[model samples]
Target: MTLPTTEDRDPQSIGLSAKPDEEVLAHILQRQIVALEAARDAMPQIAGAAAALHAAAASGGKIGYAGAGSAGLTALTDCLELPGTFGFPADRMRILYAGGAKNLMTLAGVHEDDSEAGFKDFQESGLGSRDVLIAVSASGTTPYTLSAVQAANDAGTETIGIANNADTPLLREATHAVLLKTPAEVIAGSTRLGAASAQKAALNMMSTLVALRLGHAVRGHMVNLVADNEKLRLRAQRILQDLTGCTPDDAAIALQNAGGRVKTAALMLLKNLDVDTADRTLALHDGNLRPFL
Candidate 1:
């Protein structure tokens, strides 16, 4: 096995020649474009990871995310969005920051290099066969992330590694690996500049796709989105109105009785059916509105 690198890692600590104000501005703009382009190019990786995660979720498996440094925060953000946006089941999603629980919301850079700690974290948690573990590391060599991947693989869990560098050890160790090829940061080795942004974009796509597979979406609309805010409530009313051929006012009225259930509200008003009957009919149709039509 190739040994891990103990080379100087901090980009800021590296020999980056500072330029004049105009040159710095130009470099910043260039890096921004590169970062977005890198994100676009990394779509397939996210798609593959999402497909794997969605299948595991369907099979009653828990989804876990692990990462180090800024990538860890990205993993946490991605996992958190799944629940609030798609109503994902609680307790089935997990995110592990390398510094453990206390490191969240704080920058604890040293923890990124600790593989033993990472392995212990996984062992302490109840990882099992019906679980998928995803590790995010821009360099594809964070000792912490690699450790978690190895532990998860040892546990017979599906493992996905997300990294900016190609041909890294974590890639070979993981069940699946996504290589996001972004240009080196304008600020040198600072992956938080470009790599974190790309990782976040990929994760956003992955989680959203998984939600789609779980029936939280229909076509392009978020049919299962919770109407917990005024914006979403308006959206729900509009959806019911459009589907049932009713006035917005009428749809809003039906929505109240349907407990803000857009599908039930539309069917109740348009089919001239009660809430119970509408709900039962939707269930009978397997929740596909087109079939009901």
Candidate 2:
């Protein structure tokens, strides 16, 4: 059964900051409790999604986040960065927003209730049993998110629903459900404030920590990053030089041998192996190039 909307929270205790003006303080006092509680409440559902995603990746499947509005934006941010930062393939992750890619930059509101659109997106992506789907909505009633979740379930893909309201419809249908517990906005019902922040935090936990647990991070660094650009190229050089005491010039050449892969370059320098050896070793051990080096 769905829980009650808002989950009956106090809007005071959430704002713990003591160093703000009266106006700001009052605003915090009026909404802090509910705002944070909203995020706190969703932890369980987020945990489920994370677990499913980790399992899916381990089994050669993918993880996807679907939503509209702020939730969709945050998911997109996480998905696009998966490759450049952690070196996951584009197919390993996806963020399906209600509006198409064209609407990502424009402020035009997507049709939140477009169930058919959600189904089509899920279908086009070939949702399957190996995948995990995360559906986000502050109100717990966005039709697009709901449709996607339902489609994922039908395809045997695990599904997690995130919402601010308790006992929400989406929650009831999803395999796992978590409530954010955010109440009406400080300005009334504007969920963009607390709800959005809560969603970001939960998503951060899912992607960043999942990456870490799955060996995407090394010594707290994005070592498996794809060094395909000027900024990332420099980052690869710095990482290589820092790890192996190589000169800038030597690091640059090593990076080339490693095909501009920071982690691979570091492995080559540290292990004193050729690029081919480093590549083979890292591929053997799930890209933990540093340890292999």
Candidate 3:
């Protein structure tokens, strides 16, 4: 059997260990650029996946992520940030990392081979037809990730597979396949280098597009962001100011009255609506500020 390109050694790195420090670092940086290009190549598939994810979220459905090792960490980073970044509900996101949190410190390679664990985790995640799952694997054949995608398919849940290899089971089975054809890793099978970069870039695009479609992002600002910190509170203020041309005091008052929700505050100021009416009107428009603006 032919090894996947991710496992194939790059001829350019034949003497990488003996190279000068600058040359070695330059090679690594160039490979990262290539990985990002791979993500750019998958824009169409990423857009489709984002559309599906947006549909699921709009319909009050959950989003799940499954992976192992480096891929799992990438997915976890994206999953955990959704709520704070876009005001997506934390309860609506599920993570199915192989070996769960107990093994996160080590991320044992053995866990990636545990197909049963993957299937069990997916079954217990409560993801159904209304939900969507994104599974990532460099080789596109990791047992744990593949099993989770298969289980999701069986449950009639939409799935987006992000893989570095071509024609693998994950890609063939997933509802939307995002193939990130990253170059072979400089360290051969160590996909954490280039493959992880491509996966992260692809996921970033997908999630950002979903946020834009949901109207959580407007004019490049994260309008629906959960301003739970001082920095974010300041950002919320700025967004209100930029969008409404309101004074700092007026923006602060609107933010307070609207419970720090940028969209609600914007509507309250822009439409001359009271706080209660603004909140209700924003909800009536499905939290989409574009309609009100």
Candidate 4:
């Protein structure tokens, strides 16, 4: 039977099961390298997707993610961290996966083929023209994922598709598409090893670049991070100190006055403003630190 590229056998690992441990690991590592390379090759598409999402965010739109199985989890990783990492509002992020939330941990692959389920889920998300949806499927043919993309697009929401194959419906169904084109896995048909990696790398770059574009980061630091716990709170203090050359004691005071908000605290220290004034300035600049600094 003919198979997709991701399901094809890797000739180098013809006797993979009989190989020595070191040789097996080496083969897997090579696949990982190829996956990363595929991600790198898709940077132009990633940049376009990031810009589209940024524009949606500026227009008060939400970001949504849709996928199935490993792809779904990889997409979740990006959506879940936006609030903690870049201080994105939690209400503005949404995730839809095959089999729904109850089956999240089980990852029932059968649900991936249910196109109607995907469409129904997106309909319930209340997506609108201001929203952006990212649909992920390594093979670019997962019925559930493609259905979500179709539903979102029909609703006037821009959809970005990420897949590992060219000329696939998933790529053609979206407003913007990212193709990772990773090689087949050493263990034939096991896409989680290579395809998943490429999807993750592409998602990482796209989401991080979007956050940076939104002024959530400055000088390689997370200026808009939500410092909820001790570790992040300490990191916020260090960020303030790094940005303003303030002492630890002063940083701590600023953080407290800013209510554990990293960006506001940094602005308070750098601009020598009180908490109220710092907040007002940050709001005026859309929470960007570069203008105040």
Query: Higher-TM-score candidate among 2 and 4?
Result: 4
C-alpha TM-scores of all predictions: 0.81, 0.84, 0.97, 0.97
Query: Candidate 1 lDDT, tens digit per residue, 1-293?
Result: 53222222434324335557676676667666677676678677678878889888877788889998778888888878776576666688887779877887687889998989889988876777888998988888889989989999999988988888878988889887787777667655677777788788778778777766666665566666557689989998877766667898898888888887766776788788898998899887645455443
Write one digit per residue (lDDT tens) for candidate 4, span 1-293. 97788778888778788988998898889878977899888889999999988998877799999999888988888889888888888898999989988878788889999999999999998778999999999889999999999999899999999998888999999999999998878788777888998888888887788778888888989988877889998998889888899999999999988889988888878878898998999888887888766
Against the reference, the lDDT scores of all candidates come to 0.77, 0.76, 0.92, 0.88
Candidate 2 lDDT at 259 equals: 90
By lDDT, rank the candidates, best first: 3, 4, 1, 2
Clash pairs (backbone) in predicted model 4:
none
Model 1, position 152: C-alpha lDDT score: 93
C-alpha positional error of residue 259 in candidate 3 after TM-score superposition, expressed in Å: 1.8
What's the lDDT of the predicted structure labeled candidate 4?
Answer: 0.88
For candidate 3, what is the lDDT?
0.92
Which residue runs of candidate 1 sit more than 4 Å off their true CA positions? 1-26, 261-293
The segments of candidate 4 whose C-alpha lies over 4 angstroms from its true place after superposition are: none
Ten-residue segment with the worst summed lDDT in candidate 2?
A: 2-11
